[model samples]
Target: MSLAETGISDAPLILGSHTLRSRLIVGTGKYDTLELMQQSLEASGSECVTVAVRRERLYDPTGRNLLDYIDFHRYTLLPNTAGCYNAKDAVRTAKLGREILLGLENPGADWVKLEVLADTKTLLPDPVETVLACEQLVELGFQVLCYTTDDPVIAKRLKQVGATAVMPAGSPIGSGQGILNPNNIRICLEYLKGEDPDYPVIVDAGVGTASDVAFAMELGVDGVLLNTAIAHARDPVRMAHAMRHATEAGRLAFQSGRIPRRLYASASSPEDGVIGRTRQDRTSQ
Candidate 1:
Protein backbone atom coordinates (compact mmCIF):
# COMPACT_ATOMS: atom_id res chain seq x y z
CA MET A 1 0.00 0.00 0.00
CA SER A 2 1.09 3.53 -0.72
CA LEU A 3 2.10 5.77 2.20
CA ALA A 4 -0.46 8.37 1.14
CA GLU A 5 -3.19 5.73 1.44
CA THR A 6 -1.89 4.69 4.85
CA GLY A 7 -1.18 8.26 6.11
CA ILE A 8 1.75 10.04 7.79
CA SER A 9 0.98 8.73 11.27
CA ASP A 10 0.89 5.13 10.06
CA ALA A 11 4.35 4.38 11.43
CA PRO A 12 5.74 7.26 13.36
CA LEU A 13 9.28 7.20 14.70
CA ILE A 14 8.88 7.13 18.46
CA LEU A 15 11.90 8.21 20.49
CA GLY A 16 11.41 8.19 24.21
CA SER A 17 8.34 10.35 25.00
CA HIS A 18 8.16 12.07 21.63
CA THR A 19 6.38 10.77 18.53
CA LEU A 20 8.35 12.28 15.66
CA ARG A 21 6.90 12.67 12.17
CA SER A 22 10.21 13.16 10.40
CA ARG A 23 12.66 10.27 10.18
CA LEU A 24 15.73 12.39 9.45
CA ILE A 25 17.51 13.72 12.56
CA VAL A 26 20.08 16.44 11.85
CA GLY A 27 22.95 17.83 13.95
CA THR A 28 23.44 21.46 14.92
CA GLY A 29 27.18 21.39 14.34
CA LYS A 30 29.68 22.23 11.53
CA TYR A 31 27.44 24.94 10.09
CA ASP A 32 29.14 28.21 9.20
CA THR A 33 26.62 30.32 11.12
CA LEU A 34 23.59 29.95 13.35
CA GLU A 35 21.27 31.57 10.81
CA LEU A 36 22.41 29.16 8.10
CA MET A 37 21.97 26.23 10.44
CA GLN A 38 18.42 27.29 11.24
CA GLN A 39 17.54 27.65 7.55
CA SER A 40 19.00 24.27 6.68
CA LEU A 41 17.22 22.59 9.57
CA GLU A 42 13.91 24.07 8.49
CA ALA A 43 14.47 22.87 4.97
CA SER A 44 15.45 19.39 6.15
CA GLY A 45 12.07 18.90 7.87
CA SER A 46 13.79 17.22 10.78
CA GLU A 47 11.87 17.07 14.05
CA CYS A 48 14.92 16.11 16.14
CA VAL A 49 18.33 17.77 16.08
CA THR A 50 21.43 16.69 17.99
CA VAL A 51 23.49 19.37 19.71
CA ALA A 52 26.88 18.79 21.27
CA VAL A 53 26.60 19.57 24.96
CA ARG A 54 30.29 20.33 25.32
CA ARG A 55 30.67 22.67 22.33
CA GLU A 56 27.38 24.58 22.34
CA ARG A 57 26.93 27.68 24.43
CA LEU A 58 23.70 26.61 26.07
CA TYR A 59 23.80 29.63 28.32
CA ASP A 60 26.08 32.35 27.08
CA PRO A 61 26.86 35.02 29.67
CA THR A 62 26.97 37.61 26.91
CA GLY A 63 23.32 36.92 25.97
CA ARG A 64 24.42 35.09 22.80
CA ASN A 65 23.65 31.42 23.22
CA LEU A 66 23.02 28.57 20.79
CA LEU A 67 19.70 28.03 22.52
CA ASP A 68 18.78 31.59 21.63
CA TYR A 69 18.67 30.69 17.92
CA ILE A 70 16.94 27.34 18.28
CA ASP A 71 13.18 27.18 18.79
CA PHE A 72 12.83 24.63 21.56
CA HIS A 73 9.16 24.11 20.74
CA ARG A 74 9.76 23.30 17.08
CA TYR A 75 12.55 20.77 17.31
CA THR A 76 13.66 18.22 19.85
CA LEU A 77 17.05 19.15 21.34
CA LEU A 78 18.97 15.86 21.39
CA PRO A 79 22.07 16.49 23.48
CA ASN A 80 25.04 14.31 22.49
CA THR A 81 28.36 13.39 24.11
CA ALA A 82 30.53 13.96 21.06
CA GLY A 83 33.97 14.53 22.54
CA CYS A 84 33.88 12.08 25.36
CA TYR A 85 36.48 9.25 25.11
CA ASN A 86 35.45 7.21 28.13
CA ALA A 87 32.38 5.99 29.99
CA LYS A 88 32.86 8.34 32.97
CA ASP A 89 33.23 11.46 30.83
CA ALA A 90 30.31 10.48 28.61
CA VAL A 91 28.08 9.88 31.63
CA ARG A 92 29.15 13.21 33.13
CA THR A 93 28.35 15.02 29.92
CA ALA A 94 24.91 13.40 29.78
CA LYS A 95 24.19 14.46 33.36
CA LEU A 96 25.20 18.01 32.54
CA GLY A 97 22.91 17.95 29.51
CA ARG A 98 19.97 16.85 31.67
CA GLU A 99 20.69 19.53 34.28
CA ILE A 100 20.89 22.19 31.60
CA LEU A 101 17.70 21.20 29.78
CA LEU A 102 15.46 20.28 32.75
CA GLY A 103 15.03 23.97 33.44
CA LEU A 104 13.65 24.44 29.94
CA GLU A 105 10.13 23.38 28.97
CA ASN A 106 11.11 20.75 26.41
CA PRO A 107 10.08 17.11 26.17
CA GLY A 108 13.48 15.93 24.88
CA ALA A 109 15.38 17.16 27.92
CA ASP A 110 15.55 13.67 29.36
CA TRP A 111 16.86 12.01 26.21
CA VAL A 112 20.62 11.82 25.42
CA LYS A 113 22.62 10.65 22.38
CA LEU A 114 25.55 8.69 23.83
CA GLU A 115 28.90 8.28 22.05
CA VAL A 116 32.09 7.10 23.73
CA LEU A 117 34.90 7.20 21.21
CA ALA A 118 38.01 5.06 21.49
CA ASP A 119 40.34 7.73 20.06
CA THR A 120 40.33 11.03 18.23
CA LYS A 121 42.14 9.68 15.19
CA THR A 122 39.66 6.94 14.38
CA LEU A 123 36.60 8.64 15.84
CA LEU A 124 35.12 5.14 16.16
CA PRO A 125 32.85 4.35 19.04
CA ASP A 126 34.25 2.37 21.98
CA PRO A 127 31.85 -0.59 22.24
CA VAL A 128 32.72 -1.35 25.85
CA GLU A 129 32.52 2.26 26.99
CA THR A 130 29.33 2.85 25.00
CA VAL A 131 27.56 -0.13 26.59
CA LEU A 132 28.82 0.90 30.05
CA ALA A 133 27.59 4.47 29.64
CA CYS A 134 24.23 3.30 28.28
CA GLU A 135 23.71 1.13 31.36
CA GLN A 136 24.46 4.01 33.68
CA LEU A 137 22.33 6.50 31.75
CA VAL A 138 19.37 4.12 31.61
CA GLU A 139 19.65 3.56 35.35
CA LEU A 140 19.74 7.32 35.82
CA GLY A 141 16.33 7.61 34.10
CA PHE A 142 17.73 9.03 30.86
CA GLN A 143 16.51 7.71 27.51
CA VAL A 144 19.82 6.85 25.85
CA LEU A 145 20.27 6.72 22.04
CA CYS A 146 23.52 4.84 21.65
CA TYR A 147 25.91 5.39 18.72
CA THR A 148 27.93 2.27 18.04
CA THR A 149 29.58 0.19 15.32
CA ASP A 150 27.49 -1.92 12.92
CA ASP A 151 27.96 -5.07 14.94
CA PRO A 152 24.87 -7.21 15.57
CA VAL A 153 26.19 -8.55 18.85
CA ILE A 154 26.98 -5.08 20.21
CA ALA A 155 23.62 -3.71 19.01
CA LYS A 156 21.74 -6.46 20.86
CA ARG A 157 23.91 -5.81 23.91
CA LEU A 158 23.07 -2.12 23.82
CA LYS A 159 19.39 -2.93 23.60
CA GLN A 160 19.76 -5.36 26.50
CA VAL A 161 21.39 -2.53 28.45
CA GLY A 162 18.22 -0.45 27.94
CA ALA A 163 19.26 1.78 25.09
CA THR A 164 16.14 3.45 23.73
CA ALA A 165 17.60 3.47 20.22
CA VAL A 166 20.53 1.67 18.63
CA MET A 167 22.26 3.95 16.06
CA PRO A 168 24.81 2.01 14.06
CA ALA A 169 27.30 4.03 12.04
CA GLY A 170 27.31 3.62 8.24
CA SER A 171 31.09 4.05 8.53
CA PRO A 172 33.63 5.96 10.62
CA ILE A 173 32.62 9.44 11.73
CA GLY A 174 33.26 12.22 9.14
CA SER A 175 34.49 9.64 6.60
CA GLY A 176 31.31 9.86 4.47
CA GLN A 177 31.89 6.31 3.32
CA GLY A 178 28.13 5.69 3.26
CA ILE A 179 27.11 2.26 4.55
CA LEU A 180 30.39 0.43 4.00
CA ASN A 181 28.80 -2.86 5.01
CA PRO A 182 25.09 -2.97 4.19
CA ASN A 183 24.98 -6.63 5.20
CA ASN A 184 26.19 -5.81 8.68
CA ILE A 185 23.63 -3.02 8.97
CA ARG A 186 20.90 -5.40 7.86
CA ILE A 187 21.99 -7.94 10.44
CA CYS A 188 21.94 -5.34 13.18
CA LEU A 189 18.43 -4.29 12.20
CA GLU A 190 17.15 -7.87 12.09
CA TYR A 191 18.68 -8.89 15.42
CA LEU A 192 17.49 -5.80 17.26
CA LYS A 193 13.95 -5.81 15.86
CA GLY A 194 13.45 -9.54 15.60
CA GLU A 195 10.58 -9.63 18.08
CA ASP A 196 9.65 -5.94 18.28
CA PRO A 197 9.36 -4.63 14.73
CA ASP A 198 8.92 -1.05 15.90
CA TYR A 199 12.30 -0.99 17.63
CA PRO A 200 14.19 2.09 16.50
CA VAL A 201 17.40 1.20 14.66
CA ILE A 202 18.78 4.46 13.22
CA VAL A 203 21.68 4.82 10.84
CA ASP A 204 24.03 7.40 12.33
CA ALA A 205 26.87 9.18 10.45
CA GLY A 206 28.87 8.35 7.24
CA VAL A 207 26.11 9.59 4.94
CA GLY A 208 27.68 11.79 2.25
CA THR A 209 24.67 12.77 0.15
CA ALA A 210 20.94 12.47 -0.46
CA SER A 211 21.29 9.09 -2.17
CA ASP A 212 23.07 7.69 0.88
CA VAL A 213 20.26 8.80 3.14
CA ALA A 214 17.68 7.29 0.76
CA PHE A 215 19.62 4.04 0.57
CA ALA A 216 19.79 3.78 4.31
CA MET A 217 16.08 4.36 4.62
CA GLU A 218 15.51 1.67 1.96
CA LEU A 219 17.27 -0.76 4.29
CA GLY A 220 14.23 -0.42 6.61
CA VAL A 221 15.99 1.49 9.36
CA ASP A 222 13.66 3.38 11.67
CA GLY A 223 15.45 6.69 11.02
CA VAL A 224 18.71 8.47 10.20
CA LEU A 225 21.02 10.82 12.20
CA LEU A 226 23.51 12.95 10.32
CA ASN A 227 25.54 16.19 10.57
CA THR A 228 28.53 16.85 8.35
CA ALA A 229 26.83 15.74 5.14
CA ILE A 230 24.45 18.67 5.18
CA ALA A 231 26.55 21.12 7.22
CA HIS A 232 29.56 20.82 4.93
CA ALA A 233 27.68 20.95 1.66
CA ARG A 234 28.33 23.92 -0.62
CA ASP A 235 24.62 24.66 -0.58
CA PRO A 236 23.49 23.43 2.75
CA VAL A 237 19.86 24.50 2.55
CA ARG A 238 19.29 22.90 -0.87
CA MET A 239 20.98 19.71 0.26
CA ALA A 240 18.78 19.60 3.31
CA HIS A 241 15.68 19.88 1.14
CA ALA A 242 16.93 17.06 -1.07
CA MET A 243 17.57 14.88 1.97
CA ARG A 244 14.05 15.47 3.26
CA HIS A 245 12.46 14.28 0.01
CA ALA A 246 14.94 11.44 -0.39
CA THR A 247 14.07 10.04 3.02
CA GLU A 248 10.34 10.14 2.26
CA ALA A 249 10.83 8.62 -1.18
CA GLY A 250 12.97 5.82 0.19
CA ARG A 251 10.47 5.04 2.92
CA LEU A 252 7.59 5.01 0.48
CA ALA A 253 9.45 2.66 -1.86
CA PHE A 254 10.16 0.28 1.01
CA GLN A 255 6.53 0.28 2.12
CA SER A 256 5.21 -0.18 -1.41
CA GLY A 257 7.39 -3.28 -1.82
CA ARG A 258 9.87 -3.76 -4.67
CA ILE A 259 9.59 -6.57 -7.18
CA PRO A 260 11.96 -9.51 -7.14
CA ARG A 261 14.79 -9.84 -9.69
CA ARG A 262 14.78 -12.58 -12.34
CA LEU A 263 17.41 -14.03 -14.64
CA TYR A 264 15.03 -14.05 -17.67
CA ALA A 265 12.96 -11.17 -18.92
CA SER A 266 9.16 -11.40 -18.70
CA ALA A 267 6.88 -9.88 -21.35
CA SER A 268 4.37 -7.31 -20.15
CA SER A 269 1.88 -8.09 -22.96
CA PRO A 270 -0.30 -11.19 -22.68
CA GLU A 271 0.80 -14.31 -24.60
CA ASP A 272 -2.82 -15.48 -25.10
CA GLY A 273 -4.04 -12.18 -26.54
CA VAL A 274 -2.80 -10.91 -29.89
CA ILE A 275 -3.27 -7.32 -31.06
CA GLY A 276 -1.85 -7.35 -34.61
CA ARG A 277 -2.24 -11.02 -35.63
CA THR A 278 -5.44 -13.15 -35.60
CA ARG A 279 -5.99 -16.91 -36.16
CA GLN A 280 -6.60 -16.41 -39.91
CA ASP A 281 -3.37 -14.40 -40.30
CA ARG A 282 -1.38 -17.10 -38.47
CA THR A 283 -2.81 -19.85 -40.76
CA SER A 284 -2.02 -17.77 -43.93
CA GLN A 285 1.59 -17.17 -42.66
Candidate 2:
Protein backbone atom coordinates (compact mmCIF):
# COMPACT_ATOMS: atom_id res chain seq x y z
CA MET A 1 0.00 0.00 0.00
CA SER A 2 1.08 3.56 -0.55
CA LEU A 3 2.10 5.75 2.40
CA ALA A 4 -0.96 7.93 1.93
CA GLU A 5 -3.26 4.91 2.02
CA THR A 6 -1.67 3.84 5.32
CA GLY A 7 -2.64 7.18 6.96
CA ILE A 8 0.88 8.49 7.67
CA SER A 9 0.02 11.80 6.07
CA ASP A 10 -0.70 13.48 9.40
CA ALA A 11 2.22 12.55 11.68
CA PRO A 12 4.42 15.49 12.71
CA LEU A 13 7.90 14.38 11.61
CA ILE A 14 10.99 16.58 11.35
CA LEU A 15 14.75 16.05 11.30
CA GLY A 16 17.25 18.88 11.74
CA SER A 17 16.13 21.71 9.41
CA HIS A 18 14.48 19.44 6.88
CA THR A 19 10.99 18.04 7.23
CA LEU A 20 10.86 14.33 6.42
CA ARG A 21 8.20 12.82 4.21
CA SER A 22 8.50 9.48 6.03
CA ARG A 23 8.73 8.99 9.79
CA LEU A 24 10.90 5.88 9.36
CA ILE A 25 14.66 6.49 9.48
CA VAL A 26 16.83 3.70 7.99
CA GLY A 27 20.47 2.66 8.39
CA THR A 28 23.17 1.96 5.77
CA GLY A 29 24.84 -1.12 7.19
CA LYS A 30 24.73 -4.93 6.84
CA TYR A 31 23.56 -5.14 3.25
CA ASP A 32 25.12 -7.91 1.18
CA THR A 33 25.81 -5.55 -1.70
CA LEU A 34 25.77 -1.80 -2.28
CA GLU A 35 23.11 -2.27 -4.99
CA LEU A 36 20.85 -4.05 -2.56
CA MET A 37 21.44 -1.35 0.02
CA GLN A 38 20.33 1.29 -2.44
CA GLN A 39 17.21 -0.67 -3.36
CA SER A 40 16.31 -1.26 0.27
CA LEU A 41 16.77 2.39 1.16
CA GLU A 42 14.66 3.55 -1.76
CA ALA A 43 11.93 1.05 -0.93
CA SER A 44 12.01 2.04 2.73
CA GLY A 45 11.19 5.65 1.77
CA SER A 46 13.53 6.97 4.43
CA GLU A 47 14.71 10.56 4.09
CA CYS A 48 17.60 10.09 6.53
CA VAL A 49 20.20 7.28 6.69
CA THR A 50 22.75 6.68 9.47
CA VAL A 51 26.44 6.09 8.70
CA ALA A 52 29.16 5.20 11.21
CA VAL A 53 32.58 6.86 11.31
CA ARG A 54 35.88 5.05 11.92
CA ARG A 55 39.17 6.92 12.02
CA GLU A 56 41.46 4.16 10.76
CA ARG A 57 39.31 3.46 7.70
CA LEU A 58 38.91 7.09 6.69
CA TYR A 59 41.50 6.87 3.92
CA ASP A 60 40.85 3.31 2.78
CA PRO A 61 40.08 3.49 -0.94
CA THR A 62 38.48 0.03 -1.17
CA GLY A 63 36.50 0.25 2.02
CA ARG A 64 32.73 0.66 1.83
CA ASN A 65 31.68 4.27 2.36
CA LEU A 66 28.09 5.50 2.49
CA LEU A 67 28.97 8.42 0.20
CA ASP A 68 30.14 6.01 -2.48
CA TYR A 69 26.66 4.56 -3.03
CA ILE A 70 24.13 6.94 -1.49
CA ASP A 71 23.12 10.07 -3.38
CA PHE A 72 23.90 12.81 -0.89
CA HIS A 73 21.50 15.28 -2.45
CA ARG A 74 18.58 12.95 -1.95
CA TYR A 75 19.25 11.69 1.56
CA THR A 76 20.49 13.35 4.72
CA LEU A 77 23.54 11.59 6.14
CA LEU A 78 23.36 11.26 9.95
CA PRO A 79 26.91 10.36 10.88
CA ASN A 80 27.21 8.46 14.16
CA THR A 81 29.86 7.85 16.83
CA ALA A 82 29.21 4.11 16.96
CA GLY A 83 32.26 2.58 18.74
CA CYS A 84 33.21 5.39 21.04
CA TYR A 85 33.63 4.57 24.73
CA ASN A 86 33.39 8.02 26.28
CA ALA A 87 32.29 11.60 25.68
CA LYS A 88 35.69 12.72 24.44
CA ASP A 89 35.96 9.95 21.87
CA ALA A 90 32.44 10.62 20.64
CA VAL A 91 33.10 14.34 20.27
CA ARG A 92 36.35 13.77 18.41
CA THR A 93 34.80 11.27 16.01
CA ALA A 94 31.85 13.58 15.39
CA LYS A 95 34.18 16.42 14.50
CA LEU A 96 36.04 14.22 12.04
CA GLY A 97 32.80 13.08 10.47
CA ARG A 98 31.75 16.67 10.03
CA GLU A 99 34.95 17.48 8.18
CA ILE A 100 35.13 14.34 5.98
CA LEU A 101 31.53 13.24 5.46
CA LEU A 102 29.37 16.31 5.91
CA GLY A 103 31.99 18.59 4.30
CA LEU A 104 32.27 22.39 4.21
CA GLU A 105 28.85 22.90 2.63
CA ASN A 106 26.98 21.66 5.68
CA PRO A 107 29.81 22.78 7.95
CA GLY A 108 27.73 22.60 11.07
CA ALA A 109 27.12 18.85 10.60
CA ASP A 110 23.89 20.00 12.23
CA TRP A 111 22.95 16.52 13.46
CA VAL A 112 25.04 13.94 15.31
CA LYS A 113 23.86 10.48 16.43
CA LEU A 114 25.64 10.13 19.79
CA GLU A 115 26.44 6.59 20.99
CA VAL A 116 28.85 6.01 23.89
CA LEU A 117 28.76 2.40 25.04
CA ALA A 118 29.78 1.50 28.61
CA ASP A 119 30.10 -2.23 28.04
CA THR A 120 30.73 -4.43 25.05
CA LYS A 121 28.32 -7.17 26.13
CA THR A 122 25.04 -5.22 26.25
CA LEU A 123 26.25 -1.97 24.64
CA LEU A 124 24.18 0.03 27.12
CA PRO A 125 24.77 3.73 27.43
CA ASP A 126 26.51 4.96 30.58
CA PRO A 127 24.15 7.73 31.60
CA VAL A 128 26.89 9.63 33.37
CA GLU A 129 29.22 9.67 30.38
CA THR A 130 26.44 10.15 27.84
CA VAL A 131 25.06 13.18 29.62
CA LEU A 132 28.53 14.69 29.84
CA ALA A 133 29.04 14.21 26.09
CA CYS A 134 25.64 15.57 25.25
CA GLU A 135 26.27 18.76 27.17
CA GLN A 136 29.61 19.27 25.46
CA LEU A 137 28.24 18.53 21.97
CA VAL A 138 25.30 20.87 22.39
CA GLU A 139 27.62 23.60 23.52
CA LEU A 140 29.62 23.01 20.39
CA GLY A 141 26.52 23.87 18.31
CA PHE A 142 25.54 20.36 17.28
CA GLN A 143 22.00 19.02 17.30
CA VAL A 144 22.52 15.98 19.50
CA LEU A 145 20.44 12.85 18.95
CA CYS A 146 21.39 10.71 21.92
CA TYR A 147 21.20 6.91 21.99
CA THR A 148 20.23 5.98 25.52
CA THR A 149 18.40 3.47 27.71
CA ASP A 150 14.67 3.42 28.40
CA ASP A 151 15.04 4.95 31.84
CA PRO A 152 12.89 8.02 32.35
CA VAL A 153 15.47 9.68 34.56
CA ILE A 154 18.26 9.29 32.04
CA ALA A 155 15.97 10.56 29.31
CA LYS A 156 15.12 13.59 31.43
CA ARG A 157 18.77 14.30 32.06
CA LEU A 158 19.61 14.00 28.38
CA LYS A 159 16.88 16.46 27.47
CA GLN A 160 18.07 18.88 30.13
CA VAL A 161 21.57 18.58 28.67
CA GLY A 162 20.30 19.84 25.27
CA ALA A 163 19.52 16.68 23.35
CA THR A 164 17.30 17.38 20.35
CA ALA A 165 15.82 13.92 20.79
CA VAL A 166 16.12 11.05 23.27
CA MET A 167 16.56 7.68 21.59
CA PRO A 168 15.94 4.79 23.99
CA ALA A 169 16.81 1.25 23.05
CA GLY A 170 14.06 -1.35 22.73
CA SER A 171 16.82 -3.82 23.63
CA PRO A 172 20.59 -4.07 23.18
CA ILE A 173 22.05 -3.23 19.80
CA GLY A 174 21.30 -6.01 17.25
CA SER A 175 19.47 -8.14 19.85
CA GLY A 176 16.25 -8.02 17.80
CA GLN A 177 14.29 -8.63 20.99
CA GLY A 178 11.68 -6.04 20.12
CA ILE A 179 10.64 -3.68 22.91
CA LEU A 180 11.94 -5.13 26.19
CA ASN A 181 9.99 -2.75 28.41
CA PRO A 182 6.97 -1.09 26.90
CA ASN A 183 6.21 0.64 30.19
CA ASN A 184 9.62 2.30 30.26
CA ILE A 185 9.32 3.43 26.67
CA ARG A 186 5.88 4.83 27.42
CA ILE A 187 7.27 6.63 30.46
CA CYS A 188 10.09 8.08 28.38
CA LEU A 189 7.57 9.35 25.88
CA GLU A 190 5.52 10.90 28.68
CA TYR A 191 8.56 12.58 30.19
CA LEU A 192 9.71 14.03 26.86
CA LYS A 193 6.32 15.39 25.89
CA GLY A 194 5.71 16.76 29.34
CA GLU A 195 9.05 18.55 29.56
CA ASP A 196 9.33 19.73 25.97
CA PRO A 197 6.35 19.02 23.80
CA ASP A 198 8.36 19.60 20.63
CA TYR A 199 11.30 17.43 21.57
CA PRO A 200 11.31 14.22 19.52
CA VAL A 201 11.46 10.72 21.03
CA ILE A 202 12.94 8.10 18.72
CA VAL A 203 13.19 4.32 19.31
CA ASP A 204 16.83 3.47 18.56
CA ALA A 205 17.83 -0.23 18.70
CA GLY A 206 16.70 -3.88 19.07
CA VAL A 207 13.83 -3.46 16.66
CA GLY A 208 13.48 -6.88 15.00
CA THR A 209 10.57 -6.54 12.60
CA ALA A 210 7.89 -4.34 11.12
CA SER A 211 5.72 -4.84 14.18
CA ASP A 212 8.38 -3.36 16.44
CA VAL A 213 8.51 -0.26 14.23
CA ALA A 214 4.72 -0.09 14.24
CA PHE A 215 4.55 -0.47 18.01
CA ALA A 216 6.95 2.41 18.51
CA MET A 217 5.00 4.71 16.20
CA GLU A 218 1.77 3.75 17.90
CA LEU A 219 3.29 4.73 21.23
CA GLY A 220 3.66 8.32 19.90
CA VAL A 221 7.35 8.11 19.08
CA ASP A 222 8.55 10.67 16.57
CA GLY A 223 10.73 8.21 14.62
CA VAL A 224 12.81 5.00 14.67
CA LEU A 225 16.47 4.13 14.00
CA LEU A 226 17.36 0.50 13.29
CA ASN A 227 19.99 -1.48 11.39
CA THR A 228 20.69 -5.18 12.05
CA ALA A 229 17.06 -6.23 11.76
CA ILE A 230 16.76 -5.31 8.08
CA ALA A 231 20.38 -5.82 7.06
CA HIS A 232 20.64 -9.35 8.51
CA ALA A 233 17.27 -10.54 7.26
CA ARG A 234 17.19 -13.41 4.74
CA ASP A 235 16.10 -10.97 2.06
CA PRO A 236 17.30 -7.60 3.22
CA VAL A 237 15.62 -5.70 0.41
CA ARG A 238 12.21 -7.22 1.14
CA MET A 239 12.67 -6.65 4.85
CA ALA A 240 13.44 -3.02 4.11
CA HIS A 241 10.17 -2.65 2.24
CA ALA A 242 8.33 -4.28 5.13
CA MET A 243 9.95 -1.89 7.58
CA ARG A 244 8.78 1.08 5.55
CA HIS A 245 5.20 -0.14 5.36
CA ALA A 246 5.11 -1.08 9.02
CA THR A 247 6.25 2.37 10.15
CA GLU A 248 3.64 4.10 8.02
CA ALA A 249 0.92 1.79 9.29
CA GLY A 250 1.92 2.41 12.88
CA ARG A 251 1.92 6.19 12.47
CA LEU A 252 -1.51 6.14 10.89
CA ALA A 253 -2.88 3.89 13.61
CA PHE A 254 -1.67 6.32 16.26
CA GLN A 255 -3.13 9.39 14.55
CA SER A 256 -6.52 7.69 14.19
CA GLY A 257 -6.38 6.82 17.88
CA ARG A 258 -6.72 3.25 19.07
CA ILE A 259 -9.85 1.93 20.70
CA PRO A 260 -9.82 1.64 24.48
CA ARG A 261 -9.69 -1.91 25.82
CA ARG A 262 -12.73 -3.08 27.75
CA LEU A 263 -13.19 -5.94 30.19
CA TYR A 264 -16.62 -6.87 28.79
CA ALA A 265 -17.71 -7.59 25.25
CA SER A 266 -18.82 -4.61 23.25
CA ALA A 267 -19.90 -5.70 19.83
CA SER A 268 -19.94 -3.39 16.83
CA SER A 269 -23.08 -5.19 15.60
CA PRO A 270 -26.38 -3.50 16.44
CA GLU A 271 -27.69 -4.47 19.89
CA ASP A 272 -31.30 -4.25 18.65
CA GLY A 273 -30.84 -6.67 15.78
CA VAL A 274 -33.41 -9.43 15.39
CA ILE A 275 -32.49 -12.63 17.31
CA GLY A 276 -32.43 -15.32 14.62
CA ARG A 277 -33.87 -14.99 11.17
CA THR A 278 -32.95 -16.49 7.81
CA ARG A 279 -34.27 -15.57 4.38
CA GLN A 280 -34.80 -19.30 3.65
CA ASP A 281 -36.77 -19.81 6.91
CA ARG A 282 -36.24 -22.73 9.45
CA THR A 283 -38.30 -25.28 7.48
CA SER A 284 -36.22 -24.91 4.30
CA GLN A 285 -33.12 -26.63 5.69
Query: Which candidate achieves the best lDDT against the true structure?
Result: 1
- For model 1, residues 33-143, the per-residue Cα lDDT tens digits are 999999999999999999887655566668667888899988889999999999999999999988877877777789999999998898999999999999999999999
TM-score of each: 0.90, 0.90
- The global C-alpha lDDT for each of the candidates, from Candidate 1 onward, is 0.90, 0.85
Provide the RMSD of all predictions against the true structure, rounded to 1 decimal.
3.6, 4.0
For residue 159, model 2's alpha carbon misses the true position, in angstroms, by: 0.6
* Per-candidate clash tally: 0, 0
Instruction: Write one digit per residue (lDDT tens) for candidate 2, span 1-285.
Output: 655677645635765565777778888887889988898899888988888886466667788665678888788788899889999999998888777655635423687999999999989988898999999999998889999999999999999888988999999999999999989999998988985666789999999999999998899888889988998999988998899888878887888899999899876886454468664564484
The pairs that clash in candidate 2 are: none
